[model samples]
Target: MGLSFDYALLNLGRRPTRTVLTAVSSALVAALLVCTAAFVRGLEQSFTGAAQPDVALLLSRVAEGDVLRSSVQAGLGALVRANVPGVAVVSEEVHLACNVTVPGSDGARAAMVRGVTPAAYQVHDAVTLTEGTLPGPGEVLVGRLLARQMRVDPSRLAVGETLVLEGAKHRVSGHFAAPGTAIEAEMWTPLEALRGIARRPDASVVFARLEPGADARALQLFVDRRLDLELSLLTSEQYYADLARYLAPIRALAMAMAALIAGAAFLGGVNTAAAAVQDRIRELATLRALGFSTGALWRSLAQEAVLLGSFGALLGLAAARLFLDGGAVRLAMGAFTLGVDGPALALATVATLALALLGTLPALLRLHRLPIAAALAED
Candidate 1:
């Protein structure tokens, strides 16, 4: 049978308010889906991108997965370098999660403070010295995205500004960037200075870079041989992978909210479609009596659903561009920007159309087997 959308197009005009409401409901669901997809994608990309395949962390197993709580002997780096054959360089780094204040700013903000040696530059090659100079005894250098991650004023972290940490003042020496990594939100200072500030002689961890093609199993074996060290070997990839799993609940929660809104949209679509059929029973019966095929009638209903879905998809994309795109979301590790890329947009659009198309099922079934004689005789 031939299909036509002329009657479907005209039907939408019969009750303009209902048509608008149905489209708006679909838009809300689509907007939630697009934003959730963007959030989940950005979160995974940032966490996974931060990992280095060959670098390993030597930390106390007691600290579990928290690097900030780890404590390894300061001399462990030297021992590892001497014992391990393929070890290129080892950096004894300290990680401190603490609050900091700007000299003139009133409130304090949380910051990730890392104490590093010059060898850290060799191990963490992803880091680059972008501006000013290396941090000296009483100064610190910040990452490029530190201000945004910390939600502080850019001037407060400028090259020449002073940052207060635990009642002590330290100058901001420079800002560096480690693209696609969580490292770009921390403040780095000299190891010796942080040792004095934190009043702990132990280093947080010994981050070691292995030579190309070297096995990380050797590092674990080294730890195994010396139970006295109490150090556990964790590769950078393993650390980030564990971090992503820990944060999985957050992504699930976002998708769950989107699913709830989608259910609401589906119900709205069904209500709208059922109402349209009920209002036009007599008119529809007349068409059936006049020789219009059941396939043509079903196609017309499908057309209306598609139109609503398409319009709503576009509206949702517009909402995502206005609100979620380029938006920063803060997490325990760091912050990442929500990106509404092509894949996210496409997925959300498809979901909207599918939900709309499925909603026509009940209405189509009723109209398909309608008793034309009774429908025409009714008031």
Candidate 2:
């Protein structure tokens, strides 16, 4: 005979404290799993989504993936504009990944400084000035999200504030925003001023916009054939996509840590389940004597574990939604919001259920080994 649904539920209530503790432990594991997965996935999406599909990024052939390390003659922008067909706009840019000390503090934080011209505004149309104006020589425009990325006060990045970069004092001319993109974490300065400060004679990358109806493939091929230029071309979308792949190791580490945490939680749950089953041996043996099949006994216990897991998962997801969702996590590359999207929630659900069933296995094995008469005779 199969146990009634009420019978399974009542079993959990028989030891309410144990049941609550186990569920809470599982909930913590679920929260950790969801947050970790969401953080990595959000970072990947933020980076890959930053690229505009209508533009192409030209990098030095020697530094294909490392834009900060790449250097191409500043004059190359003019050359490309003059020679490359279907190119409507060309913006020369210099990128440097450096650390800057916070104002009035000895603490330092990493920052990406970009040297750009007015043409850059046209190429990256998503950027919009929120305060003050575009940067002029000796001035810089800070991304609206830069303060958050650097984990500093937003007022420190306000217009008129000065930030020392490479030992050069540069006033913050404005604040700009480019939501959901890596650009939101960068600081922009005038091309000439940044070159002088960074002591670089060349630009890091060239951005080119294609005219409507123009063939991106043909433009890429044209750059590829320019052996004298020694340049590599990638669509802006492809560039950010490549950047996401470059940061895969960090994401992998996050996933591994989440797995380790979940494994520990699972072990804790196993111990709880084993103790609960040990206490209920006589009850289970009495059911067996009442014509309950072994499969029915197993199913009843499994149902209880799953029910506990489901409740825990709900609590964990709620906690994550309240605390983690939309929260920004800063990395070496930039800041990405923690996303508790559908996939992350679904994964948490599956992990919770799996842990519930797998964690109960030891208890089930112990049940199978107990002699019916001996189990019922226990005090």
Candidate 3:
């Protein structure tokens, strides 16, 4: 409707190829930002959701005692129960990784094995024993995903099926699913059962639940005062966040890669926009000679750039969605599904607009310094 709109259309019509290329470049950058941001957010949510708000975890300073280790003193569990008031129960955790051969497949895959108390089910609702009964000592409960990979019907993985863990036999007593969480990739066994396999009397970590009205900081202080045990207390929420730190290096690397890719795309898009603008110099000069204001010309150029960016963005987003929806990607320490959330989509849209705006920068600067007489004479 406006003079600027008309001018933009004229320029684009004169150099359709360059305009399209600029748009494509913008779209790619936008898509990468959207996807990377979504990945970081998803990982954060997954880890935080894995732990409960009120629960606390106790670990030795010696091993950086978290779920990753194999040993903590068996007597220490009793000491925490005696000293920490309003403390519910202390559950020992043992972690192991082993290879299992899937039925009908000669290949083997590694899986995580966790040992926890029966109270773990109550302390952490995210962990649900979906079918069959909890594992007795020398028995184990596996996650649904692992069950599927194992090619064993979870319901049919009865108490007597021999499950080999590091060449030792344990019965498959149960199956569980911690939906949308990393725990789904693991199997559970009793704390005592893991002692021998762990080759130590100490469990990996002690998970504690504070009583209602108990001060978390106070409990932590009390535990801190006991210098002999070398223990540290972390609330469940903080614990998971801390654990996520391990993945930070990889996430940062992904972001850096995305940035590099996006930067290349932006540079390419800018070059395209510059080429497109150069081709339309004669037409733009004609408009100015015919009394089109500088502002009008500028707006028109910006609009054209924006359109290209927007179209590119939409195309890129469509590509990402089609390829990533429900697709699984491996992450540091775990794997996650690609989720196309509202924020990610919005980021993509913004990227498209930004690309267009950036593309117009050089053209606007050039136009400001251009000689009207020279521009007109070129035509």
Candidate 4:
């Protein structure tokens, strides 16, 4: 008869300490894998999710695609709507970074701020005013992740609190959230109010939303025909895609860390498997003498490994769900929450089991050629 799973379970029970140790190691590795996947997934979502197919941008021809340094006439939005055929709405917007001070706070914190008219809400459809009304004159709407993004306390930007910007105090109107998009880290204000405060007479960029199935070429053609306007066009997809590439190094670093963690886990599994094999040399030989094949003993060892890994991976998943799931992390690109979703869990499980199986390789390699006669004669 072949070795059954019951035999494997019995072997594990005999070495309580060894089984617990290996299982614990597997759990730690699994938990870390979840964290890595969450970070990389969250970063990609923030960029890609912000890109909308129907939207495009107007920028100064000399500024390339960078909006921060771009400037155009203040009324470009209305001009585009009146001139372009396929355009449905055009929003005049200004994006800038400035220092904001909360009352009773020690120092000013720098944050990204956007100035926009009501049309901006339609162009950036991802944003939802979850907590408060749209911003009015001398008022600001903070994003849900603003506290983490700015590395400031959440209480500092609470509704009804006043924030000082450019020596002018503006009340926080409410909070908004755009899940999986970077806009959740920014604060928005009324277009005229912010323009007055910053003393900027021109719009930094024009955001245009084209009608469904609208020819995007109309936007390009409009800008192309008016070389005198010194304006260029870029799709929202193209801009956000470039931003994703610019941040690739961070993802690469996270994968590198994962590789290192995998290496450690593999080595640990191999060591545990080797020790168990060595300790059971005589018993394994006894089984061989009892008409059990070398293959059966090897399979029995693999089954034992699978059991330990499954238990450990499950424990790790539980701990991660409790502690790390939905947690937020800050980066230079603002903040993003951990994505402990199905894919991450699947990846962690597969990695753990695969490593467990591979860990049996060295010991299983020597099993077939084992000197059953000599092993059985041992004291």
Candidate 5:
């Protein structure tokens, strides 16, 4: 006959301190796994979600992944408009992915600055002005989430405030909102004014909007035919996808670190289980004398390990939801919120159960060789 479920639970209660410590260790490992997965998944979703299929990004061939390093002639937007068919709008902008010191901050922080023309509003229709108006020379507009990205109060970045960038003072003229896009972490200024500040004679990129029924392949072919431009074209979706691919190594590193921690926890659990089995040898021998089979005892021990692991897994999931949910992690591109979704929780649970089973193997093997006579003779 199999060991009773109630008896298996009783075995865990006999050593409360050891059981609790082992469970806590498992919980820590599970939480780490969940947080790492959530962080990477959130970043991927943020980048992929920001892409608009109807827009094409034009960059220098050498700056395919890093827009800040890209520089093309300022007149490229005009040239594309004149040469490419099915082009609805041309939004030319200068991108500066630089570090700036905010007022009351201790050190320099990374920020994205865009030098844009009035036509920029036409192409990026998702951007809506929330306050004030379009910026003129020496003036700038801030994204609604820029304050959050800088880890500052929103009131500090209010309209009429001054933002010092590269030793140049730019007055905040307005605030804009671009929901579900990476632009939410950026600041905008007049093309001529930012060009002077950046000391660049060219724009970093051109964003072209396609008309209805227009395809990006035709635009690519058009750019390919223009040998003089030295330009590369990608759909906005493809651009962000490439950025996600470039940052994949960071995600892999996070997962690898988590796995190492989990492996240590698994070893700890194995030791804890072995000790518990040793301490219970006499009791198990008494049960064997009472007609319980060896298989029944082994099954009971496995159940106890699973029970302990499940408790730890529940605690870890709760901790992840309370702490990691809604937490924002910033990367080189922008910031994305950590998501403790259903899939993350499920993965943590499965990993916890697998660790529990693996941890019991050594104890099970020991039980196979345990002589009922020897165990019963112990003090």
Candidate 6:
């Protein structure tokens, strides 16, 4: 039988307020889930890219979430280099989650600081010196984004421009960028600059870079043999994965919020669909009496729901991209940018369409069982 889609369209238009409410409800939920999912996934990317694949990290397995809390003697940095044949380079770097005040052209704001050795640039190849020079004792290299936020030029941040770190003033010597990671939002300094606060009697981790074809497992075993020192060995990838695991609690919380919001949306959608069908019962019954097949009626109802849901999905995704993109939030790893990637938009659309399918089911069944004679006789 030929379909009269116009009939369904006219019915939905007749009840404009209810239709609009349903659409708005679906849009709100889809937006929340999309933005939250993007932010959580973005945090993962920020930390993962910060880690170097060719590098192996040495830390205490007993240490908790903070790498700064993990301690390996400074001597081990040298020993790991000398003992491992495949190792090409090693450095003892210090990392802190503390905040610092930065002076920018726009004004001053608080941001995270990262202290690293000169070899940090070597291991993290993407860390390019964009301006001025490398950091020396009592000096720092601010990240490109952080420097911009602080309104200070790399070259202009003269040797005497005092940057207070945990109440101690350190000079700005250079500026750097880590391309696409959140590290670019932090300030870098010489490991010695944080001496008193970091209490680096021991280094946070002994970072070693391996030569090509060198098996990380073999190297891990080699370092694991030094369990007497209670040192745990891991490839940089493992360390990144561990960092993701460290942020699992926050991720879980994000997922929980998405679930709650999605659940409410689903329920609201069902109610809206049910109300749309109830209000149109007489018209639908008239169609049945006039010889429209139950299957045809089902198709029309499902099609309308899909159309409404698709509109809501598109609206939600657009909102996320326009409003939430590049939004930053603080996490244990550091502050990370919220990413609204293609996959996230696709997921949000699919999820909303699925909910539409669910909402359409009850309405379809209600129309199918109407008695043609009674439907036609009804006022």
> What is the C-alpha lDDT profile of model 1 across 164-224, one tens digit per residue?
9866899999988776567877889999999999897999999899999997888988999
Local distance difference test, each candidate:
0.85, 0.85, 0.70, 0.88, 0.83, 0.72
Encode model 4's per-residue lDDT on 332-353: one tens digit a residue.
6477778789998999989988
* 10 residues in a row with least lDDT, candidate 6: 100-109
lDDT of 4 at 305: 89
Count clashing residue pairs per candidate.
0, 0, 2, 0, 0, 4
lDDT of 5 by residue, 225-282 (tens): 9868788988888888988887789878987887887788779768877887789889
Model 3 residue runs over 4 Å out of place are 4-23, 75-79, 104-108, 128-140, 143-163, 169-181, 196-200, 225-228, 331-333
lDDT of 4 at 193: 91
Per-residue lDDT for 7-126 in model 2, tens only?
Answer: 889988888888888889878988998998898888777776678778998889899667988888888888888888888999999999867665965577789999998999999977
Count of backbone collisions in candidate 5? 0
Residue 187 in candidate 6, Cα distance off native in Å: 2.9
Question: Residue by residue across 125-224, what tens digits does model 6's lDDT show?
Answer: 7688887778777677777566444444644455446666666667777777675466777777777666565565666777788888776775677666
> Model 6, 123: alpha-carbon shift in Å?
2.1
Better of 1 and 5 by TM-score: 1
Better of 3 and 5 by lDDT: 5
Q: How high a TM-score does candidate 2 get?
A: 0.87
Weakest lDDT window of 10 consecutive positions for candidate 2: 98-107
Clashes of 4: 0
Q: Give the number of the best model, judged by lDDT.
A: 4
What's the ranking of the predictions by TM-score, best on top? 4, 1, 2, 5, 6, 3
Give residue 214's error in model 2 in angstroms.
3.8
Clashing pairs in 6: 103-150, 104-150, 104-151, 105-151
Instruction: Return whichever of 5 and 6 wins on TM-score.
Output: 5
